[model samples]
Target: MSEHPIPDAPQRRTPGDEFVQALARGLEVITSFDAEHATMTLSDVSKRTGLSRATCRRLLLTLVELGYVRTDGKAFTLTPQVLKLGTAYLAGLGLPQVAHPHLEKLSAALGESTSCAVLDGTDIVYVARCSTRRLMTVGITVGTRFPAHATSMGRVLLAAERDLALPETLPALTAHTVTDPDVLRAELVQVREQGYAVVTQELELGLRSIAVPVRTSDGKIPAAINVSLPMNSPLDPLDRLDQVQATARAIAEDLDHLH
Candidate 1:
């Protein structure tokens, strides 16, 4: 979870005849829990998921019975069993299996943390990572997520997915974060032209990162890779962009072979 509040779940584009609203609402209830809201009361969940108290209770109780959530009579928290859902998703993609070795090599070469992530809604979700040390206040690992507008990898993904609308006024994660949509859009255009992005002290005060997009052989931009370092590090992120780009290309090549 982040310091920012979770946004409401997105509505379906065209929930047609076979659409199951109950299942969708149930998933929303489960996703409402994050690191910041790890332990939420029934009212808290209802508010976060935008579900009625009755609906929230029923879904929470169902999750609890299914071993996905646990309750202490008053508050609720996700259980380890919930990891199964994320695990199934990752296993289906086989992304970690394909990228972990390359990320490890890249991290070893750069002596920095390297990660692979995909855009989901307005955020980036880490699918694979190789960390050299703890850099941010929160631990960066598989399944970690960050707002798209304020991160290097997020910018790369957003630049690649041009049709996804950028919010008019993005949240300022730090003093250096780009909040104006037009300014951010221009930066993304530059990123698109240059084929990479570098973010400095945006997501956090002491963090800087550089990222490149990873594309498949058929020309699909599926994910992005990044290397994170201290904001005041001696090495310039641009000086090492070539290496990061090479790693991204290698990962993409491997993924192409997989397909």
Candidate 2:
């Protein structure tokens, strides 16, 4: 891949000596590695985290020594050990526990894959999923992430944002993917107006998905629920929206109290 500039770092606020910036920076370094950037150079890591080369190198080395990062002396990548962090959060929240049965039920009823996801920056991370059968070359899992701009769940979550912003450049994942930021903004507008999002082959050819918001009692959309199918599937997204929306609302209702 060509060199790319990383997004700006979040504003740092110094609270007190008890606030360990080093620890925070170390975690940020861990987050710099993802599916799209499974491996990165020291400079890439530095650029992504907005940390100095020396700082980034130190953190990476520390993580390496701690078995959280691995390097072949050229490019560095995170180890599976990093999954423990996300697992800890998942275990604490019990999201899968609350969402798995609902997803399974939906999948059975619709004969497709159903997933619960939450937005993570510009990506949507699957938190729970159930599939009636294999539907794609790559299977969906709890930690799977897809670009928000090209996915139904992502658009649904994005539309729920108070004021959505699109960068001038959007990655084109497929020929059908929306690359123009302006066009994508218009699509998001339509999604909000329609109270749902339907994506057709934007991420992959023959894949279609529809998503709806899972709102809390406070009306905040912390997550979304989606059902995915092949373009040639017998059922259309709208045909199953009734059950999907009801399941999402039920999950949100339970989450409001559980959380």
Candidate 3:
């Protein structure tokens, strides 16, 4: 008998090999500084990303050279120039011009807050929001981010993200947040099966919301629409859920037509 050799499997692409991947990591380093960690030493960045201090310093220097970051004697912080990167992405999306008015209409009709969100890693970012009043406490605004496992918009977006790799155990963000990965996976499954997601007081106390996918004519979900209400609001959850789902579907249909 002749000897045979086994076939080799294809090698996977590493983060370092992809074009623009390094730029993304650098941008992440810039974004890692926020109000709480507005100014951080090189050691702080190393601790946050678990990268070596040398690596963090190199990236930080690159970012500073690009005008996306500024540094003092011992600490570094993001500069306003960093907004341009995010602004360029938002400009390319072209969603705000089309969806902002619809969000406003939804909020006006329902007397609640409405928003459009897209997935960002393990979080959902509000790209557009319409506030009905000034009484809410979540302090949500455009560019705000919230954990996907704890919000209706996050679950709806996750459900639409069939390619996303979900873990077996989820990290908790709050007391009511779902920590069991299985439960979150089940919730995502339910969202897909039901075509919408309803979350109550998971991200914060008295915060309730419902979300539905915003799909294109080709049935590709690029974002999600959601209505946020207070837990103690007199409005019934089922009623709000129906309204939000219907409005979101209508918006999706309108977008499909435009596309």
Candidate 4:
């Protein structure tokens, strides 16, 4: 679950009283804590968030008083209370309510695992998943994140972006991962043309997945869904592409009807 911070999206508003810099800085402090840096010292937080020690300390103290952060007199870690924020956001979107049934149906149909994720900067964060069994070393949960360049869902989501961004260097999760920028771009082109993406043992050994974008009625791809299985599985992922894509469309249609 090691991941980079979710990069801030470009905002139209300029800095002003309307835009609360302190609130933004407070959120930055919260986001600085991730799986890789679950617990950090004052200096670590300041360095990670690019906030001064004085500001970091003040914010940390405030978060502590608010029960969103806990410190053992040295290292600070986020409290479970912080999860309420993410939970509130998911509830607001009603995505789990809309997508979970479809994921379960797809998983049952394919006798495999199904998941839905949204692009968050350089990673894809799983927001809903239905697992048949453990297929990888790390557990796949609602909050699990994987590198965008080496995942089927990530590729499908990235394909939908008009301006795809990639780091100067891509991390090779496994021997089969496509790290070369030129080659990865070629594969993205194929994914765009074919309307799906198949990643073979790129994220981990013996793991393969196929993903398709979940497009709303207005043709906006807000998320991507995928079916994951071991490399030794008897079923061909391509053969099940139609089923998975149909499930994705169903989920999208149901989501659109909500509005």
Return the TM-score for each candidate structure: 0.91, 0.77, 0.79, 0.84
lDDT of each: 0.89, 0.85, 0.76, 0.88
* lDDT tens readout by residue for model 1, 1-259: 2544666655555788999988888888988888778899999998898778999999999999999999999999999998998899899887888999999999999899999999898889999999899888788778888889899999999998768687778988888999999998899999999999999999998888999999888988889999999967787999999999899899999998888
Alpha-carbon error at 242 in model 4, in Å?
1.9
Of the two candidates 1 and 3, the one with more favorable TM-score, higher being better, is 1
- Across residues 1-259, which tens digit of lDDT does each residue of candidate 3 receive? 1011111222224655446856655755765665557799998877765556887898999888988888885999888887787888887786766678888888998888899998888788888999876544445677777778888889998888777787777756557878887778888999999888888877777777888888777878878988888877887756777667666677777776666
Weakest 10 consecutive residues of candidate 1 by summed lDDT: 1-10
Maximum-TM-score candidate: 1
lDDT of 4 by residue, 147-227 (tens): 898999999988888798777778888899899988988898999999999999989889999999999999899899999
Which regions in candidate 4 have their CA more than 4 angstroms from the true location?
1-21, 40-55
Residue 226 of model 2, lDDT score: 91
lDDT of 3 at 88: 85
Candidate 4 weakest lDDT stretch, 10 residues: 1-10
Model 4 residue 89 CA deviation (Å) reads 2.7
Record all residue pairs in model 1 with backbone atoms less than 3 Å apart, i.e. clashing: 1-35
Model 3 misplacement above 4 A: 1-25, 132-138, 162-164
Alpha-carbon RMSD of each model? 2.2, 4.5, 9.6, 3.7
For candidate 2, the 10 contiguous residues with the lowest summed lDDT are: 1-10
Query: In model 1, which runs have C-alpha deviations exceeding 4 angstroms?
Result: 1-4, 8-16
Q: Per-residue lDDT of 115-181 in model 2, one digit per residue for the tens?
A: 9998988888889988877766666778887789988999999888867777888998779999898
